[model samples]
Target: MDRIPILRMGNFLLVTIQVDLYDRLAQNLESDLVQMVSKTGARGVLIDISALSIVDSFMGRIIGNIGSVSKIMDAETVVVGMQPAVAITLIELGLELKGVHTALNVERGMQLLKEKILIEESEPDEE
Candidate 1:
């Protein structure tokens, strides 16, 4: 089983996918990422998929699952640097990827995360 490394960046978790994603690897990534969010109390997750030229439906679901789980953990998820082909594939596959934000690159992704965090922080708690 191949493991994709998850890096902790302050209040965010960074994952840069450098290798091709397989079913097992995708599953591992989803579980590992959600666990990491809980363990680290992260406020956001940034996934850079610029290297992947194509994404199958399974991979797309895993990505969506990661975002959904992160949100449940009170952390935002941002997917950045996705190639046009991959985006098209995901759309064609009808992968909505709810709760996921997107940016053009890592820098922009980080910025988006920060903005979201700040907005969340400034909002008054309902409780």
Candidate 2:
């Protein structure tokens, strides 16, 4: 069982996937990530998949699940460093990842996360 490391940066959690993920591994990652977010109270999650050259529907769904869980926990999720081929494949496979945000790299993703957090913080809370 391979465990994906989740690094905490300020109010954000960074997940960098450097190897191809098997089904169980991906599933575990999703579960672990959601738990980490809840435990740490992170405001944002940055998933860097630059090293992944291949992704199937299951993997795509796991990513979507992570994003959804994060949002429900009041945190934003940003997927970064997606390979061009993987992006095309995901689209062709009909996995649009609707609720997940994307970025070209980690730096841009971090900036985006910060901006999003700021915008969210500025918004008035609903009674």
Candidate 3:
């Protein structure tokens, strides 16, 4: 599997990759994503899963892992572009992503991230 593509835009990190439903794509992806979150302290992440045709246990676990790490780093995770079939499969499989967030599309995810950043920035300082 190919390494996931990553883009850093302002305070958001965008990831694009083809998930094969099997293999180490998820693990490889997490490595790159973790680096981005750690290095930039990015306020949010947009994971584009449009290319994936299915979601399996491995993939679901990886998503959960990414969410945990991101939370630890103070970054929010938003999965985007997940297909309907994939969504159903994940739900049926009982893949409970404890702390991960999802969006119907990348644009919406980006908007959510922007709002989060804006709110965080605008909050008054607490002594």
Candidate 4:
């Protein structure tokens, strides 16, 4: 069983997928990420999938599920470094990955995540 490294950078968790992911690995990642978010009280999640060239429906769903769960935990999820072909394939597969934010690269993703956290923090809570 392989575990994906989740690095904590301030209030964000950074996960860079350097190799292809199988179904079980992806499932474990989703579960581990959600747990990390809960335990660390992370403000956001940055997933860099630049190394992956292919994506299937299962993978897409796992990504979406991660984002959804993170949001429920009050953490934002940004998926960055998606290849053009993979994007197209996801679109063709009818998996738009709703509720998940995306960026061109890791740098941009981190910037967006930070900005989001700032904006969210500045907003007043509505009762």
lDDT of each: 0.91, 0.92, 0.83, 0.94
Residue 125, model 2: lDDT of 72
Error of 1 at 59 (Å): 0.8
Best by lDDT: 4
lDDT of 2 by residue, 12-109 (tens): 99999998999888989999999999999999999999999998888888999999989999999999999999999988998998778999999999
Query: Which is superior by TM-score, 1 or 2?
Result: 2
- Candidates ranked by TM-score: 4, 2, 1, 3
Model 1: per-residue lDDT, tens digit, 72-102?
8999999999998878878888876676899
Model 3 segments more than 4 A misplaced: 123-127
Q: Which window of 10 residues has the lowest lDDT sum in candidate 2?
A: 118-127
For all predicted structures, in order, the TM-scores are 0.93, 0.95, 0.87, 0.95
Colliding residue pairs in candidate 4: none
lDDT of 4: 0.94
Clashes of 3: 0
Which candidate would rank higher by TM-score, 1 or 3? 1
Error of 3 at 111 (Å): 0.8
Question: Residue 58 lDDT in model 2?
Answer: 82
Question: Model 2 scores what on Cα lDDT?
Answer: 0.92
The clash count for each model shown is: 0, 0, 0, 0
lDDT ranking, best first = 4, 2, 1, 3
